[model samples]
Target: MNKVKLLNISIDNISQAEFFEKCKSGVVFTPNVDHLMKLQSDPEFVNTYKDATYKLCDSKILFFISRFLGTPIKEKISGSDLFPAFYQYHKDNEDIKIFLLGARVGVALKAQEKINAQVGRTMIVGAHSPSFGFEKNEEECAKIIELINQSGATVLAVGVGAPKQENFISKYKDQFTNIKIFLAIGATIDFEAGNIKRAPKWISEIGMEWLYRLLAEPKRLWKRYLVHGPSFFWLILKQKLNFYVDPFNSDYSEPYKGVTREEMG
Candidate 1:
């Protein structure tokens, strides 16, 4: 498999169609600019990423950067796009039962309803909007795990945002005996639930989705886009100049080195 290395992380170089064919079961984490920045400082987030079955490219900015690095990614497979495609691809498969975990109180339920309606069947078998800071509470996490197991879901898609969602999956993925596929999809649940509007296709295609989102929720997303996002380019430059360093490992200097789950262990 081909990989596009940006700075400290490597993104899988795969198209949406290829992803659908290859990824039958396993944890999928889509890495964007925000995720990349988070990985720079957060050892926990980096560890969580190391456990991911698929580290997919979720940002057009990252895609463009890969080109600048001379290893162009095949496609950008953002979580918001991947979720709809995933259900649509498995629409006829009765075995693809999905349980959504994220968003506000009624948001996951709304997303479940909308998705099932579009798929013409109950593709989403269960949905839960976990309380804020639910990841910190052991009892709450265990209860949620039991709930998902009881729902008979084969796929679990969590859209709680960033390292939180990724860390949750990394810590408790094995506890889900019935779940075959796990997706760390940030904000997709809210988009599906109609609680938030996604950027238009044209804006997304033009690689201005971040700008659109920043404008949409200025107060909430300003730091992610304005503050942390620009550092991605500087990191990319470091990689290009062969001066990039992994924060966790001082001796390592490779830019395009990909780390699999086994490699991490």
Candidate 2:
């Protein structure tokens, strides 16, 4: 696979076609610096989820921080940004079909309408909104898979938040071999459907996108930015200091006790 470097992070540079081909029966993580630091610090978590694969991507905040720290890191096109390319690809090739899974209320349909209008035509075959909680609805899940299969969708874009979306993809990839891509695009549909606003280019460039989001939905995001943001930074710093220590030398039995999968889900 082709690759690029920005700061110290190496990013894979696979085209949409190549990416779809590579993602068979495995989970792909769009990791930022914070995610990398967390994984490095907690090898047990990585080991526990060894079935999953990871790809480093440049979050805007991480990009700015890397520049400030004088580290080299290159930005890879994110899952959210894949829509335009995928839409064009679908137009050119009539064989491809896509499924949009998960979004708040009417956002998925709105996104479908918008994309269809923007592209003149679209490959979107089906869409759904799963419930918020972690409790599994096996019947509903099976119905979703059946619907995708019936619709002949070759790609699935899951809008569920991580790592639930990641978990779902990892769990269900085998059942849907006809599906070429399973992307866990966090909040992309909401932004596309006008339910949420993405930060302006300047704000994103300056790493204040989080601030913009916080300002927009303070009740929902305040804790994530104000609390988790600082903690993430501190964890990154600690990981940097521990670079000399052999990461894998530590006992694998010790798990990351701070947060449960439920909390993250």
Candidate 3:
């Protein structure tokens, strides 16, 4: 699929329906402004996104910017939007097993319980909550991988946060031969588990979800939205003025592939 370059990140121009239909067993990411900015100085993150099977735009802010830049993305397919929809789509398709990884202690288990009560519980094959630095521990990573294999899950949703979740999936996705779908959903699990409240529909519709989030957890998110958020505009301005260098060649953004399916293994 052809992707447009906003900040050197290839944002796929796909709609909600097309993205869901494209979903399968592979590393899928929903890149927002924070994620795209991180890709600038972080080569590991850049490499992770480069190999991603699906790069869905999660930020409404990015959507507006894309349109302003004359490279409009069809719609936003964020982790929160995609996660519930994925389960709802497979509500009757019990063959689609799912594994919930990441989140604070007991969060995944509680999320599984809530989802099970709402949808069918049988599809949630396994859930785990790794320690803060569990990824750094070889034995811990081994156990986590083993648990996923034992669960026989086809879909894996990693809600451990941005670059960490992305790096984890990129590092170990090939190890899960039976796995199909991987989502680097930031805090969707916490939202599902009722630990955090989402913004009202109207707020989200108008593209102020970030503001709502900043209000919800001011201490934690202040730096993310308040500090790092403002810098994104300068990058966009640079791109618009034909000054920003797209490492993958600026020509790749043309012939926009508005919608396409993921190549599932």
Candidate lDDT (C-alpha), each: 0.89, 0.63, 0.83
lDDT of 1 at 124: 94
Per-residue lDDT over 207-234 for candidate 3, one digit per residue giving the tens place of the 0 to 100 score? 8999999988899889989878888888
RMSD of 3: 4.7
Q: Which stretches of candidate 2 lie over 4 Å from their true place?
A: 1-28, 32-58, 66-71, 243-265
- Per-residue lDDT of 147-217 in model 2, one digit per residue for the tens? 78887888788877655676677777778857866666778888778888788878777667778978999
Candidate 2 vs candidate 3: the TM-score winner is 3
Model 1 C-alpha lDDT per residue in residues 22-128, reported as the tens digit of each score: 98899999999999899999999988988888989998888888888888998999999999999999999999999999999999999999999999999999999
lDDT of 2: 0.63
Alpha carbon deviation, residue 112, candidate 3 (Å): 0.2
Question: Residue 258 CA error for candidate 2 (Å)?
Answer: 23
Best by TM-score: 1
Considering TM-score, where higher is better, how would the candidates rank from best to worst?
1, 3, 2
Give the count of colliding residue pairs in each prediction. Answer: 0, 7, 3
**Candidate 1 segments whose C-alpha is farther than 4 A from its true place:** 253-265
Q: What is the lDDT, from 0 to 100, of the residue 41 in candidate 1?
A: 97
